[model samples]
Target: MQSPIHETTELEELEEFVINFRMRRLKLGFSQTDVGSVVGKLYGKALSQPTISRFEVLNLSYYKMCYLQTLLQKWLEETEDSLKHSSDLTGFYPFTTYQPIERGRLSQRSFTRAFMHNPKPTSEEFGYLAERLGMEKKVVRIWFYNR
Candidate 1:
């Protein structure tokens, strides 16, 4: 078993990592939602804004913090590489959204069009649409269910 001192030191390091991660993310002009979306896409795991906020605030478990730190480090490296190579930095990152949509705020036209095409979309379809629209999969699923 590890000593309490070791665990405390680990937590302190993680806290510092979180602070640097947030600073780097902001320096790259990424909002919490943008970071969550990009990280989610990279990891094949959906991360919400609240989750990213919690990570920045060091409210997550040690294991989760470590995992996110790894992901963020990789992302930061890629971003830096892109900046170094690309002359046009406007659209450097693959997952960078120009206009990020707020949660639970879908246009009525899109909703109507999607609903008309298929009232009940499959899980795969819903997941794709949710990521594309910057909405949650559960929200898309619920909308279809309600309509």
Candidate 2:
């Protein structure tokens, strides 16, 4: 069999895929009722025949694949298409982690200058900042606690 997909990110390719699937099923002489039976079995009757029709009309990728594979005797390229739309691989791929250098990136004078701008933070504020930084309040307490 030829590849199921011809191109990605193209509306034309998607339309053609749908048209061809429908046409081939027609060539096999399957009726909408037959499609609905399979759809009911595949997605359960809760989705129902009308729901299946709506999904097909909507070109809902997941629902289309579910309806097709069971209804039209096709493998359904849903997995491939879904993978194409998956999150950026960078999220899955590991990158070299870097840590900030000691002596900090800024001088103590600069740090004090910046830190002094904020109002005298309360124990509550220190606790919140500590939580945000994943450190104990005591760790940050020394920085803003002396107030």
Best by lDDT: 1
Per-model TM-score, in order, reads: 0.62, 0.30
Evaluated at residue 99, the lDDT of candidate 2 is 18
* Candidate 1 lDDT, 112-144, residue by residue in tens: 788888887889989887766656789878878
For candidate 2, the clash count comes to: 0
Flag regions of model 1 displaced more than 4 Å: 87-92, 99-147
lDDT of 2 by residue, 1-147 (tens): 434453334446455666666665454343444445433444464344554455456546754654444543432343223336773322221221111222233334433653677657678876665554434468666766454
- Model 1, position 57, has a per-residue lDDT of 90
Q: What pairs collide in candidate 1?
A: none
- Cα lDDT listed for each candidate: 0.76, 0.47
Q: Which residue runs of candidate 2 sit more than 4 Å off their true CA positions? A: 1-11, 42-47, 59-147
